[model samples]
Target chain A: MTKKVLVLPGDGIGPEIVGQATRVLDALIENHGLDVTYESALVGGSSYDAHETPLTDEVLAQAKDADAILLGAVGGPKWEQYDISVRPEKALLKLRSELELFGNLRPAILYKQLADASSLKPELVSDLDVLIVRELTGGIYFGQPRGIRTLENGERQGYNTYVYSESEVERIAHVAFKAAMLRDKRVCSVDKANVLEATELWREVMDRVSKEYPEVELTHMYVDNAAMQLVRAPKQFDVMVTGNMFGDILSDCAAMLTGSIGMLPSASLDANGKGMYEPIHGSAPDIAGQNKANPLATILSVSMLLRHSFGEAELADKIDQAVSTVLDQGLRTADIHTDGDKLVSTTEMGDAVLAALA
Target chain B: MTKKVLVLPGDGIGPEIVGQATRVLDALIENHGLDVTYESALVGGSSYDAHETPLTDEVLAQAKDADAILLGAVGGPKWEQYDISVRPEKALLKLRSELELFGNLRPAILYKQLADASSLKPELVSDLDVLIVRELTGGIYFGQPRGIRTLENGERQGYNTYVYSESEVERIAHVAFKAAMLRDKRVCSVDKANVLEATELWREVMDRVSKEYPEVELTHMYVDNAAMQLVRAPKQFDVMVTGNMFGDILSDCAAMLTGSIGMLPSASLDANGKGMYEPIHGSAPDIAGQNKANPLATILSVSMLLRHSFGEAELADKIDQAVSTVLDQGLRTADIHTDGDKLVSTTEMGDAVLAALA
Candidate 1:
């Protein structure tokens, strides 16, 4: 069975990075005999420019029909002036809700070679690997009864509901426990149960779901303590699962902790193992086409896409190993480069990864 | 005129640390001509044991009548088995609501002498001072229509409302801007306005509030970016203002950035400048009565009480300078102690500060 991949080179440096990533994918298909076929499509600012909308119905139909999607990045100053409905970021929200991509997996892995890049002491973040599983589609972001309203006293008030059902918690909890089983077998569920009733139920559902995964240990922490612990001692965690908003905040915080945001990849998954993969870094509009952007994160997104969506673990391992080997060879992009390391251009770095793969 | 100060020495190591803080207060009264009178009351586990309630009506009335309150931590494992209503923490929540303490000022300051204690590189957190003004009384934590209900499909749904009125935002924004006026005059209002409507109104009210404080510079950041920036470059901020939940998380994150939680103090202020001061650290039941706990944070809380509530700037500065002088003398408690520093007992640290004051 051939897995169909949709490559969305969104805006700014998207095309350059995704171009490098597809080169590696081409190698995997040609040399490694990986059974996957991919096609390119426009979305975000590019789509808005070409089709008058951030995401056209045709591109969305293509996305829904694909087995996995590889995204470069979206939104830039070019799209900032547009109304919120037609903005480049709308494409992402549309795809997420339309495809029901609820589970977001953000991995923060700090390679030992780039330990000095972190604001934290080397001991704190060196070789740090923490996977944050976030519920993406639901929670406060999409909850109803959300907007500004005028009160009887003529004062205006704003409100949003943070809501989650048992099934929602159960599904995300299973995703986290399954992920933990593959790694350290420990899941720290982050919530504010002591204060928020919504998270209190979230905690109960997590406890109920943990019975099915007896081999995996589960613990609960308040969000504030979790934030402090991330700074004080982040290594104490393996997999941290939380609601949509918490996941958004904690995942970013964890990514920054690695101090090499250019090397992180993320995945938004659906129930049936289909996912959209992308680098955690945003499109670098200022450095776009200058060959200064880092493509390693985008290349790694291909690895995640293969491992998660297609179950091609061996091919994914090869891609990950190629990345590690390139880093071991002291190949650095401008963002992660130091005086002693070789600063390679985006394409050259991608070539190095492809060469290592070969 | 004499000012009445209500002192509440709560559970675990609270009495020991508050005892030390009061010693400095006594010195200020007798030697420095500080016209203040003090009274003590039991709270938390002690109050629970004495009156079967964490906060008695008499004590609550005393707290209301006092010009300022100095507290030395709360909660311990002994009261964990009790129902949530009678729990020691309930007493603190009761005070915040009853006193209308809407503005929570949490300062994360890393003394240069103790910069080595931080997990971050010394250069990043040395002399770092960030005041987080959290709207204590409102937002998602206290929002209405929050509970878990069984749905039509027999699945339970948990929901909490995140809400803010214009006046609520105005008051907290004024708190941030006013505090900024006293400091570096920069306020960064953090919210999730792009997603949550409540925070959209929050941002709008903040912008409207900034007009009154012409000298202060106001900026906006998403809560997620604020969390990352706190870890990446914390010194770039002077004062940060947000709703209850964001403040609860970011303030703790900022506190941990200093890597010396034992030395951070916090103040909860009402609109009228009356406030309650306490250390950010909790009562360590394990280290209770061991003479090993650090009293610096509690002593610093006394300094905050004087400065915020009594307008005794000179006395507060004297206490602050004395604490600095004591730290300069190489005195250390067990928590912030490293290999080469002078390790002193709780009482000895207090005596040293008192001597420095003299």
Candidate 2:
């Protein structure tokens, strides 16, 4: 079966990085015989410039028809003057909600070659691999009845609701357990059950869901302790699943643990295993077209797209190996370049990965 | 005029550590001529054992009347079977609400002597000092309309309101700025204003309050970015203020960056500067009576009590200097004792600090 991929090269350094990622995909198609056909479309600031909306109805319909979507970052200072509803970032929220992409997979992998870049002792973070499964499109970020209101005493108060349904918890839990099965077969659910009743229910749902995955060893941790443990001994965790807000905080913390955010990729998946893959790094507007942006994260997003959306794990492993081989060759992009390493431009780095893959 | 101090040695290692702290206080009162009188009480499991309640009315009255309170620690497995309403930890919550102690001050300080203990590189955390001022009495943890309910569709939904009034944010903001005035005069307010309306009001209040403390430089950061910044370069921050939940997570993360949990102290203050001070580490039931637990955090709590509650900065500095001198002399407790350091028991560590003070 030929899987369809939608590539949305967004604003800032998006076009340059996505160009490299697509080049890698082209090689996989021509040389490796990967069965995939991809089409390009404009979204975010680029789309706004073309159609006056961050995401067009046509582009959205195309996204729905695709097996996987690859996004090359979005939003920039140039689009800041636009109204919030039509902003470049709005396209992302619209896609997430429209597609019901509730499962967000963020992997924080510290390659041994770049361990010295971390503020942590090299021994603590070298070769560290942890996947955080976050329940997106739900929780406090989108809960309703949220706004500022005036009280009877003439004081202003603001409030937002943090809510989760049984089905929501169930689906996200399945995503986490299935992800754990593919890796370490251990999933630690993070919540604040001790204080918040909402998370008390979250913990209960997690326990109920754990009974279904007998092989996966499940544990629970308070959010505060989880934060400390991430800093103290990140290696102890294999998979961590949590609500949207906690996931937002912990995943970012875990990414920083690697100290190479430029090399991190993420995927947002729906119930049907269809996903949107992208680099965790934002579009660097400062160095937009200078060919200096790191494209490894975006390229890895292609690996995620293949492995998760297209069910091509072998191809994904090959892409990962090529990345490791490039690093072993002492090739470095500007963001990750240290002393005595060969600093390569965006195109050169992408070329090295393709050559290694070949 | 003599100031009254109430000491609550709650449970587990609490008694042993508080005993050591009182010994230092005796030195301060007798040798240093500190004009403060102290009394003792029981709380937590010990209190439940004696009075069938975690907090007695008489003790609560004493706490209310006291100029300051120093709590050692609380809770152990011995009281785990008790009802949630009568749990040992409830005593602390009762005191916090009753005393209106809405300002929680948690300091993460990595002394140069203990730099090797941190997971971060020595330069990143050596001599690192950051104070986290948390809004204690309000936010999602204590919000209204929170519970699990059956939806019309027969699915169970759990919800919690994350809320903050203008006055709540204002008071906490003042606490942060005032504390900043005493330190580096830089206050970074952490919130998710871009998403959470509750924190949006929080940011607005913080901005409004910043005008009164013109000497204190105030900035805003999203909670996710704050977590990352704490891991990447913790020293860049001087004082961080946030609502209860973010503070709970970020403060613990910052404390772990020092890699010495047994050496951190905390304080909870009210609008009037009256406060309760304690060690951030919990009661270690396994080492409760072994004389192996560390007393430095509790002793440091007394130092915080003197500075924040008693306004005795000179006396607090003296106590801090003594603790530093003892560490310089190569004394260590079981929790923080590395190879080649002279291992000291609870009482021995106390004697060393006293000797350093003398």
Q: Each model's TM-score?
A: 0.98, 0.99
- B171-238 in candidate 1: lDDT tens per residue? 99988998898789999999999889999999999999999999999999999999999999999999
With candidate 1 superimposed using the best TM-score fit, by how many Å does residue B273's alpha carbon deviate from the native? Answer: 0.8
TM-score of 2: 0.99
Clashing pairs in 2: none
Best by TM-score: 2
| Candidate 1 lDDT tens digits, A1-358 | 8889999999999999999999999999999999889999999999999988999999999999999999999989988988989999899999999999999999988888889999999999998989999999999999989999999999999999999999999999988997788789999999999899999999999999999999999999999999999998888999999999999999999999999999999999998879999999898899988988999899999988887788788999899899989999999999999998998999899889989999
The candidate maximizing lDDT is 2
- Which sections of candidate 2 miss by over 4 Å? none
- Write out the backbone clash pairs for model 1: none
Model 2 Cα lDDT, one tens digit per residue, A60-94: 99999999999999988999999999999999999
Model 1 residue runs over 4 Å out of place are none
- Score residue B356 of candidate 1 by CA lDDT: 94
